[model samples]
Target chain A: MIEVAGLTKRFGPTLAVSDVSFEVQKGEVLGFLGPNGAGKTTTMRVITGYLSPSEGRVRVAGYDVVEEPLEAKRRTGYLPEAPPVYPDMTVVEYLAFVARIKGVPRREIQTRIEEVSEKCAVTDVTDRQIGKLSKGYRQRVGLAQALIHNPEVLILDEPTAGLDPKQIIETRELIRGLAGQHTIVLSTHILPEVSKTCERVLVINQGKIVASGTPQELTHRLQGYETVLLTAEGPAAEMMERLQRVSGVNLVEPRDAADSRVTFEVHAEKGHDVRAELARAIVESRWKLLELKTSGLSLEDIFLQLTTKDLGEGPDTSDKSSVVGIV
Target chain B: MRNVIAVAGKELRAYFHSPIAYLVMTVYAALLGFFFYSFTATYVVQSFRIQAMGGGMGAPPMSLNEYIIRPLLAGVLTVVILLLVPLITMRLYAEEKRSGTIELLLTSPLTDLEVILGKFLGAMALYAVLVAMTFLYVGYLFLHGNPNAKPLLAQVLGLLLYGAALLALGMWFSTFTKNQIVAGVVAFAVFLLLFVMDWVTAYGSGRASDVISYLSLTKHFDNFAKGVIDLSDVVFYVSVVVLGIFLTARSVDALKGRA
Candidate 1:
């Protein structure tokens, strides 16, 4: 339902969105994952017809954003990062206004407002001024406004931002409930939100698509080195040295152990499970085996590796360097 | 037309609820009262002398209700409009961008022209309502003085035309900057230039002087103040308003692309 081709946006010497292209089929939730300045919001704005692209075109539901903006917008609903709201207006009034602008039929406006408010779980605060609502409720109101018209395409930018853990789960459930009914392209800096709510992932970096695949596909593609943790009652350094000397054991580092017990993190080469070897060696050495477990990397590690831009063997530490203090 | 009315209705209602609008209305009513009372005092004191000398101030050929009061009103109200219109219209688009509401409005199916026109109409409607509430002064003048009614009617029409032009200029000025304070100062600066164009022209030589004078807003406004009601003056103000709206629409479109 959405197709973007060679979309480029430039402001003087700064290129906000480069030559990026992607497609989102109907009834699919595509997660756009990136760091702070990854141009995901810029691309979404171009598709929503809020910003014009310097080159190329974006089409939604078979209509060009620039050439047929009204029609394209008619089929699309957008929730910007801030959730544009008026302090004085009640939730219902705000949603009604949005419906009016979206050209919802006058007779059906109230029903549409009710439906969206219920779907977004904002029905309780429908009569209260939006300015008086909590952040979570305010976000739900924003989502309600976007879903009021029942558009086929929804583009939400950071929908779960600033919400509590419970609110985030509720929002994810709401989005999941919307699956197969609309094509959604959601952008977020939070990798876990994508892992939980989206089926497909599009990773963008510095105005370019660095990777795109399902969560499992990406994890499996990058799942070459297997990690295992071994806990034993033995000399920590000696056990680490022994494990490191093993043929399939790529690296071994000693971790903390209490009560004369030693813990080591062992990384095995591809297509090898060094767990059995470590267990047999520990039995032969009369070392007591405490615990053995496989260590799996999270989407966080995958994100860090894909976006670190440099091929390296050490644990990625760049996530801390990208912190921008709120001034 | 539906979009225009929907957007305009919401904006017009917002003006009523905003503190700035009420503050401006209070100040305006006070200024009107001050000027009206001051004009009455001056008329009574000055006309007394003329009447004693057989000039027949009482029951004279023209009453205080005549068109002479229009100029003083034109001057006072023009200054008042110069201050208030910028405040009312500056938030039309600038505040939207600052508050991120512009994104919501722009992402909708409405065209740039629709947003500009809706805001323009809304601002003008609120201004007109403010102007309309001044009808108490009309009733007061009519009851107290047997003024000639023709010129009063002409002057009212002239005020509407001149006021429309100024509102449009103010709306256009608001679109250029994100800061309302900057929008206000810039709008007043723009008005000041047009307000003082005649002075700048006076010091110059040749037809440039005449051209500047003709282009001055005050110059066209004066015809309305004097109850002249010339078509050229009316057309000139209307053209100014149209030009301002056109520029505003173009700027909105340009901003969406560049900003």
Candidate 2:
């Protein structure tokens, strides 16, 4: 439902977004994963028709944002980083105003207001002035404003930035519930949010799309080798020698030894499951097996690997074995 | 049109919901009321003095339109509006930009003209209310005196147009900055300069003098206060109003590129 091609945005001489391209299919929830100042917000703004791209084009629902802004804007709902709300107006008043501007029929404005207020869980504060509401309520109100028009595409820039933990969970649930009905593009620096909510993740760094794939794919692709953490009551050097003898074992590094238990980080060859062999070797050796678990690279590790790579290197450097070797 | 009204309605509510509207109205009413009292007192005193002279030397009875309503509308109210209009308009775009609400407005399906016109009309509505309060004071004159209604209506029309022009200019200034205080101060300074622009004409003559005198915002009101609705003055104020709106629309458009 949204396509951004060669989208480059510059503020004066500094490029905010550079030659970035991506698409979110209809009803697909796409997550923009990046650290702060990663051009995620800038790209979202260009897509929402708030800021024009300095170089390329953005289309939403088949309408060009620069050429047919009204049509594109009509089908897109945007919640900016700051939750564009007037503090003096009540929730209902603010929603009604949004409904009107978004072109909800005059007769349907009241119902639409109630509908979004219910969906965003802001019904309780409908009559209270927005300025008096808590930050969570205000953020929800911003979401309600974006949903008031029932637009086909929703562009949210850091939809869960400042919420308490409980509120964050509730917001994630709300966004997940919205998945099949609305095409969503939400940006966040929080890694877990992408794994939890998005069907596809676009990892952006330094004004570029550094990586893109499903959450599991990102982890698996970046992790070329398998790592297992094992703790056992054994002689550390002897156990390391014994594990190194097992087939497919690349290296065995001792982590720590305390209370007669030695922990080892075992690295295996790619696509190798050394757990069974290591377990059998430990069981037959007369050493008590205290702990054995496969410690795969989590999304946090993958995100750090993708974003922290040297800026001068190409994005393909992320998939190189040298980088994944550390993970 | 509906989009315009939506934005306009929001702007109007923003004013009423905040203390700014009430504060401006109260202060404006107090100042105009004080001026009305002083003008009435001076009119009464002048009329008595003329009566004591037994209408000697062909000193006709002081006309209420000349001695009271004219100066009150053309002079005192003009200065008062100069002070209060900046307050009404300073937040039109500045506050929106500051609070990030401009994102909502610009990203909506509404055109830049719709948003700009809506804001212009919203400020004009509040200013109209401020001008409307003068009617209560003006209405009292009809009860005890025979002031010409024609001149009163002309002065009111002139005052509204004058305010519309300044409000538009103030709104343009508002679009330049996110700080409301900065917008208000800069707008006030420009309005004051426009009010005194004709002062330079006293030192020069010919076409340059005429042009400066014509550009003086206060100079155009003289004909309206005298019950003459000169088309040139009407066109001048209308042109300024259009110019302000046009410049503001361009500024808002430029925001899309810069922001």
Clash count list over all predictions: 0, 0
- The DockQ assigned to candidate 1 is 0.70
lDDT per residue, candidate 2, B1-259, as tens digits? 8888788888889899889899999988898899899999999987888778787457656788998899889989999999999999999999999999999999999999999999988888889999999988888999988888998889999999999999999999999999999999999999999999998998999998998998999999889988889999999999999999999999998999994
DockQ per candidate, 2 decimals: 0.70, 0.74
**What is the Cα-based TM-score of model 2?**
0.93
Candidate 1: misplaced stretches above 4 Å? A255-262, A310-327, B57-62, B65-68
Interface root mean square deviation for model 1, in Å?
1.3
Taken over the whole model, the C-alpha lDDT of each candidate is 0.82, 0.90
Where is the poorest 10-residue window by lDDT in model 2 chain A?
A318-327
**Candidates in order: C-alpha RMSD to true structure:** 4.1, 3.1
lDDT of 1 by residue, B1-259 (tens): 8888888877887787678778778877888888877877777877777777787745644356543367445777877877777778878877787878888889898987787788888888888877875667766876866776776667677767777887788888788777888888888778777877788876787887888888988888777776678999989989998998998888888876894
Model 2: lDDT of residue A128: 98
